[model samples]
Target chain A: MFEGGLDLSGAAVRVALPELQRLTNELLRASGLQVDHAAIVTDVFMRATYRGVSHHDIYELPGRLAALAAGKVNPNPNMTIINKYAALENYEGDNGLGELGGMFIMRRAEQLADEHGIGLCAIRNSNHILASTPYVETAAERGYIGYIVTRGAPTMGAPGRKEKVIGTSPMGYAVPTENDCHIMFDACLAYASNGVLAEKAEAGESVPAHWGLDSEGRPTGDPAAIAKGTRQPIGAHKGFGLTILGEIITGILADGQIIDEPQDGTGLVGMPSHTAICIKADGLLGARRFRRRTTELAERMEARASGLQLPGQRSARSRNEMIGAGAIELKEPLLARLNEWSAKLGVQPL
Target chain B: MFEGGLDLSGAAVRVALPELQRLTNELLRASGLQVDHAAIVTDVFMRATYRGVSHHDIYELPGRLAALAAGKVNPNPNMTIINKYAALENYEGDNGLGELGGMFIMRRAEQLADEHGIGLCAIRNSNHILASTPYVETAAERGYIGYIVTRGAPTMGAPGRKEKVIGTSPMGYAVPTENDCHIMFDACLAYASNGVLAEKAEAGESVPAHWGLDSEGRPTGDPAAIAKGTRQPIGAHKGFGLTILGEIITGILADGQIIDEPQDGTGLVGMPSHTAICIKADGLLGARRFRRRTTELAERMEARASGLQLPGQRSARSRNEMIGAGAIELKEPLLARLNEWSAKLGVQPL
Candidate 1:
């Protein structure tokens, strides 16, 4: 989804990270979200922004606040474990606090993996988790291989099908390396996420024909058509195949809501499903040996790759840069939208 | 790895299933492999041919036989489970039977999942497993989600790098469905396997520029150049990213030999590594509920996809048709090579 290196500096605003986090959290609480839930959302949003994933960052605040104001996101959730197997679990997310649910489930997975060799949990009835990286990174910090899969609102079509029937269904995977560098591969199954297409549209550029299809299932380069139509999968039918499996895991196995058809006019948010898996590197390979081999493998790959930038290198670099600067820059339109939400909720804007 | 479809019927020879299997098994045994080891190889080869994946079928028999003679593939191995955790294991293949190792470990995984909900094994020092399908299909038959990852000899260059640093590193996944059909996604990270390119070369056709590169790492449509050089990964760096993870799982975790650079003109088959994982569907969702939901989900996907065939549908169709015919077709050159090996070993040909 990393396309269109748009130069939006002229139409952008820089906000201190702490200040922005505080304001977003306050806005969510003002909009009737619980304090802990707002904190979780704000933390995830700020991290996404710092990593240059602004589409899922504070830009999503307005929609989330609206969902909360409408009582679609339950402020207080009675999260509980439902189906419990030795290393597998099914959790009821209670239609509330997706970030909380994601963190809680992943922590449980880590706990189980500490006891067992591997652990997995399928979660349902939650709102959007924003980004999947935090959950995975948390496991990586504990020297575990972490993975997250979640179904989102329907925005993509099956291969060669005219209608949309699948969510973005993003996947996140992380492996810890030496010296605190972690490798992560997080991406949506679509050729490009809707956010990337919208960015191209805003920049007045045509997308690649393979990105999405027109309303008639024909490939189109027009970003407007893509916005109106649906995304094409990453690798044609192969990617659609993966998306189908993701649906079975996140939707059916979790007993979660499946998006049978799109909700066009409804303003209410729909509950999505998620699954978290954690594999203990220490348990599989002794902790020290695993750590050494992990670094050695990454080094071997880089040495073989020569000039190629490895996966997650860019994100790590971006995060470091943003942290050093202590501020994150967002496009002006997104900043205006955040300001509008603040005003609507009668909260101070950053 | 689905790209150019070549018509190889002109260069093909049809052989009865029983005769071909017998000849192949005999050839392996004559090459110093044990009877059971030969049987495992023959069975996997037959399955690949039935599914129309002839590249990894009997076409690979000559290399395997040669590897056996040269002590690259051990005829008799003392396969051992080196490390065992609650539901995870690390196996040393002893440079022996990959198909056997795959089957034994998957059966172990099944047994583990039967008790603990999930089971996984990372295997090292094995020869090529030919194809990952049979192992995964075996798990699916027991109503489990099966996955396999393996590191092949380096055949593809990383993004922006000129050297071949990665393998086809295929990922195989399978899930059972109603009506005795199962969904299987088996594909390599490369745009196409070397076997497909070799087929194109044999048919005197040039490949697409996106398929592979020349020695200089420039994209070339010449199949010969690709056979001599490296392949371009599917979806550019994204596929390469996945390959790196596969390496970490199959190579580093299993402590298998990793291909650092291309070996030119060695004619030595490098031992590859594999990992198999199985998750019991019934453990997460009740057995009956999982079965019902699996079928319902497949039906829903088919309805939404319209005339677009699902991923594994083509292979299932080909297999059924081939089985009904009671014969499998091999390209004439491959068949000749198999017969030549048999004759050299003083074994009867089909």
Candidate 2:
């Protein structure tokens, strides 16, 4: 967040947590989402926003409600279980918001793991999953190791070309510990996320070199230059390879819709597929012992590596801080847009 | 392999596949490995070498035989299934050559998947498993989607630090396809593999910038500078996070010995752990339909992206070419070392 950040979004806007939640829940309900579906979406959005996962955070609230009202997203998806084979479950999504399907499948996977030591669930025809972190974190909280991967909108350039070749393919993994710092990891295969890039571009800022490539396939630091270009993948080919793997497991294995026609989709809202695998940490060594190992690893890493930031630490710290303050600060423009969307939805503004 | 090569390693030394296998199996047997153990090691080595996985390829054959003779590694290991749940199998290795444990555990995982639709296996106390590719490929060849991950010697630097903080943590994934061209992906979390970098260093070449950082934490193009430096991760923070995730799922989950004592021990041979997961592709839409989906995805990607390289294509192509020629090539120094080690083991020269 602080790569010599350029703050051109004017002043910060503070909104109380409870107020924002009310607005989100009501807005979603008014848009025709069932109560349970609305709650799922609201909880996911809140958690992501508090964790500073800006890409899938509060900004999407308005767009989601708009999508629901316009029938772009299914208001109430059945999420039927199309196939069940022992520890594996395959669900067919009814073009619903991905968070609902993600949560539903992860819960089912946890249940399957409870019965069979491990569970893998794949859900297809789901829309953009804002973030994969929350679903994996859901399992980790239950003292289970969690893994989730989803196909993303195509944005990252392939090995050498500057055109869109594959999805960002966000993947999340988490290890539960005795304590709350659960050693979570979540990131898109791309070098940078579109949310951060868009934020930077709006701020008239330059991005880090190699974050993306210009139209000519040269690494450029200008965020605005990404308009006609593609995001750079991490490790070049290695990251691209990971993206392919993610898609295969989710899109191919789940028999989901993939964005194949457009190599370069700007802010695309294609149906994505998600895969979740969970393992009960109590399988071999009990959860307590496994958690001890993770805690020790964290301590050992902290003691030796001065600048090594352990995963899940930042988000946990951020969530704690936001809870303590009872509020979250958003860019003024973002808050205004959210209020505008709420007004259109006939809901009280945050 | 052709990253603007600096070719100082003399001419290519070709070895007949059958001759290489005989020498490998015989030398391992003479050193103390049982027939099955020797065969496992030999097959894994041959497959890796044929696929041009230089790091875990034929180059390590001599060192492994020496390790067996010197008792650094158990020649014949009893890979005991320490624990088993309905769908999970936990094996404890006896310091055996990791290739032996890898094969045994993957086979067990495959069997478990047959029974439960999915299987997850974790093996602890294993030596360095050369390449994770063969194990995952093993699952793919059996019409199942497979994944394998292994802990590595600490080599990659953590974020904002040039010193060693985490292992390279290589992971491999493969999708079962109708044809031999499965979508396979195998890569360490690091930006560049240590093996490729070491080969470059021996060639007296300047490496790619950001492949590693010098002792002073500055990205250096000189491969020689890496001796006292650390390998850079794929994405600065994202890749480091993944490396941690990999170690946890394998090292921590398996309750194995990790290389925690030394952060910068070059060429350290520590007890690593491995985790394998297998999912029968026939769980949904049947294997034939699943294979068609993968084949279609591969074809679609190829049609659009001019330079985008699909995963598994390279290794499959290399293996095919090597098979067609009935031979594999190695650098002259590697072949000389192999023959020297074979002579010491009282085996015929290569």
Candidate 3:
């Protein structure tokens, strides 16, 4: 789920982080998101682009604005806690953008964990959250292990037949390191993402045989044909069960719309459901020792990997490179699309 | 990971549950485990057999006795809580049987969650805990969500080349239903377990190509060829990442031997590591509302599944059947061996 560098082959421009951040914030606010909520969304947006997951970056700005205009996303959601028992809290997101809801859940989970050693937050009525790395990293930065899983409308098919019964929900985990660093891994339950297969289709390339299947469950290299069929689960029933397992944790606990099917009329994806869990680092040893132990584990794992890549290795490396350069590379088409949306919202183009 | 029925073709006999349990308890006790600890082990052993996973039952009793005789397992472990931070505790397992460690973790986790809404326990110096279904069911029966993950020595390979870097690391979760019922899932990260493949090898059957690979990383149907090579991860790197993630939680947090490799001279698997987490079902709403919602979600998922089997459906079905009949089918060879061990232990044989 965490990969370095969008593989788009197109004209592109480098925009400094602060510059894009400014435009993103303005565009979000102009689209009617409250200023504070817009800033939260911008953090997730900017960090995802800077870390090379550009699919979740400014590329989606125009569609998000349209979603807001069509009332599929609430600009100023009345997020509320529906239930609270000890360290666990459940919330109603009021159909807010998932970026806003995700941040709120992560922060609240950390706060609860700080006091109780472990914490959880479940939210319903959310929309699509982009990449999960940033929200998990939020807790890792505070020396807590963070977990986030969110679901949208169904898009992944299960064992019996070719029909979407659950979303390809993304899940992420972060283990803390010293100096606000983290060892993070994130992934979807599908063997391959539709985006990757669609890109291959556009390039007239045969996709990996294991990535998709015909409606009869036979392996297929034709992305076009497979699109009408099913995306394979990572390892058949194991992956399929995990997808359902994640749904049970988030959608069931949140107890709003299941997101098992799309909503009516709007044809919009089902309102999403989300859950955040955090465990305090100091909850173990007397000091900040969990960080030291985790760093050591990561180091040993790196050596064990030998020629293999560690989880999140590429993403971590690219994140540092982008942060050092202080700029993000954006495809020209994507940049132009964002600029158009910004103009429509009466904001300065990037 | 959760498949129904041992596919082994062999002569077998039905043994009453109480009769088998008495012999199992005696064998364990004679092997040096304390009476209380032996009871815990027998509970897991009996439940696994009744639920159709017999590989982890009396089939392994002789080997477990051998390990204990070799000093690889502690007979009377002083399971110390090395650290307790609010609801989270870290333990030193004292190199005991993982069944003991796992039961302790699950029971303690439930007690902690009872007071704090959530709980966790991490233990080092454990051994194979067998299937996690029993432990997770402990919490689910108490109206909580239970999660358990444990690791042994490296067995599964990773991204770059064919070399074992982590264990298959069985993991499980359970959601509570009404009347002490549960919806549970348990799985290992590998594409297939070694037990299933080895059985196929003995039967002169060609294995599924995805289940194993030749040394050069090409898929192979030859079980012998794959035994020397690498077992494929469930979804390549995704499964690889998950194996290490389990290690980070249990091994790293518990602060003991890493189990990255086997221990010196014993030729035994690395001393295992374990972790358990639970969330109170009523932690969200009053009067066990979480159970109702979870049951609703399971019913919806059953409808969504249509013809596909649910995660633990077969196991649950077999468990109820066996409990109703008060007997478990035991392959004659396995039962004969168990009787031999019981005779040597001076207990009445079946």
Candidate 4:
């Protein structure tokens, strides 16, 4: 459950992108990430905001830093290759910053794809990566089709059971396009994302009956009940099946150790891992032809459903609007917390 | 929609697996597939039955053959590589047999995973590959996580609309496990597969209310009405989003052209190019460690679920029981069709 709605007007703060990046780097450095790792982590967090995925934005920094302080997460952890092949590498993250380690693996996948026309990288012992879209979109921007899957904290309904037994288990796919309208989709297998639940709790709003179940595994609209019970799968058994698949792909296929029991504080922080596959579209088809065909297909889809919008269009539009506004809108309390954290870190307030 | 059950017992026939394979190969050969291609195609079809997925069985073969004869599909079609990288290949199938082309690409993926720890192969201009589970299971058996996606004939409901606008876009994932209990899942994005609708129509049964809508895009339970309309997404918008994602991944990302106009039937006929990625678990951790950990995870899932069985367990058990019975049990009328088709093909009745 969230504390309450934050009043943003009084706590509003603004900083140039570069200035924000510097402060982020500094804070991460203080938390033990190296320069390069800190930069990458900061970029991902900020990019989430730029893309209007504010839930995965800097709001997560305090919790992550607290984890580092509590020794629940490793700082200055090593990420080394455990195995290498023509277009693939298995990385051991040494319980490192998930954002840093995930990006590292995805970057490696991109490099391999550059040479092989396709690349796949899997990492074990990594922490949580805030958002998965950025990794795939990074590959897409490079004219590659990116596919990514990751397992996270369990908060989803299981097959045949109303109880929560799995994480949101997000999956992402991004395809490059000629214009800025890259086709990208990122979603959790759960009917609603955990962030949505948090948002509802903060607003003291009741969720839809289908969002989750009570502690007894009965459907309920109470956000508090969902917090104590299970989040419903996006499409019942289909989504539950997908969550299981995502877990298998990230937990088992990534060669990461799978911990069944909830261990640390909240739950067993499963040794997270991810699989990133990148395909060079242009390599498969001439760039012009690929673009022309994709455009034609896009036009066809639009014609078929005049009202249908591609997955990422709204997010892209929101991003552009936010950029034009020159400042991100944040809840007041969250902004206050950010200011407080900044003050404590001896960094200039945004 | 279906005539009363035909006399299956009087029409029942049994043939050795090898004999069936031989006849299947000959049938394909007669239909213009090369010997090698016929073998692959035959294997795919037989595998469906072996797995107890009779819906995708040889009963569908005659329609396909007729389609081939009508030039709706090509026989002896050439599958050409449009582009290639070390671990990736983009292929154009020239509207060839989906089963043949799909298997070829999956085999390539497996080989690449073995060599490079990962591999991806995407093909366009392919037809249907019955039962996606087999393809992914094949990779899982080889100790890799397999992912498969394909777009089928449009049958799914779109968001905010009761009309059909998307394919039954199915997604499949498989993870290797011990005790032949590999975690595998495959399902169409729709609330029900189109085959389910066909079955309902055949039985003169009404579908569930949520299953679909009538031709006017209004919800209806009449099987005939649903057949003429569109199948609802598994969970409304969520499933709609997934279907869209699948289409983009396999149809667009693969650089296979998409048919925009519903009237053209090109979209329906456009060979589904599959993108398969295999990640070698042993590459991330040592083979022994990977196996042990996966076994532990599998045990935990089995134990945690209590009365619930894993996804593929039922199908596996059914297949074993059917095989042990020395003959597959079939509804009487289907058995008659098999007999009739066998007789026409000059295959001796068992």
DockQ comparison, 3 vs 4, better candidate: 3
Q: What is the TM-score of chain A alone in each candidate?
A: 0.87, 0.90, 0.91, 0.88
**How would you encode candidate 4's per-residue C-alpha lDDT over B90-118 as one tens digit per residue?**
67878887787778788887877777777
Candidate 4 docks at the CAPRI level of medium
- lDDT tens digits, residue span B258-318, model 1: 6662223434434677888788988877878887777776676567666657767777888
Best model number under lDDT: 2
Among residues 3 or more apart in sequence or in different chains, the pairs in candidate 4 whose N, CA or C atoms overlap within 3 Å are: A6-A332, A6-A333, A7-A332, A8-A332, A154-A166, A191-A234, A262-A268, A263-A268, B126-B271
Per-residue alpha-carbon lDDT of candidate 3 for residues A284-322, written as tens digits (9 for 90 to 100): 864467677776766665576566676666778888898
Model 4, residue A283: displacement in angstroms? 2.1
* iRMS, all models: 1.9, 1.5, 1.8, 2.6
List residue ranges in candidate 2 displaced over 4 A.
A1-13, A53-55, A259-269, A331-343, B1-14, B53-55, B259-269, B330-343
Find the 10 residues in a row with the least total lDDT in model 3 chain A. A1-10
> Whose DockQ is greatest here?
2
List model 1 lDDT by residue over A1-350, tens digit each.
32223334547778888888888888878877677777876777776666676666566666776677788678778888889889889898888767778877888888878777888888888767877787787789887889888986666887656687777678888888776568887777787777777778888998767677888878898887887888877656667777877887887767776656332344333467898888888776788888787777677666767666777777888889998999888788667767887898888887
DockQ of each: 0.57, 0.64, 0.62, 0.50
Model 3 DockQ (Cα-based): 0.62
- Angstrom error at residue A318, model 4: 1.6
Considering DockQ, where higher is better, how would the candidates rank from best to worst? Answer: 2, 3, 1, 4
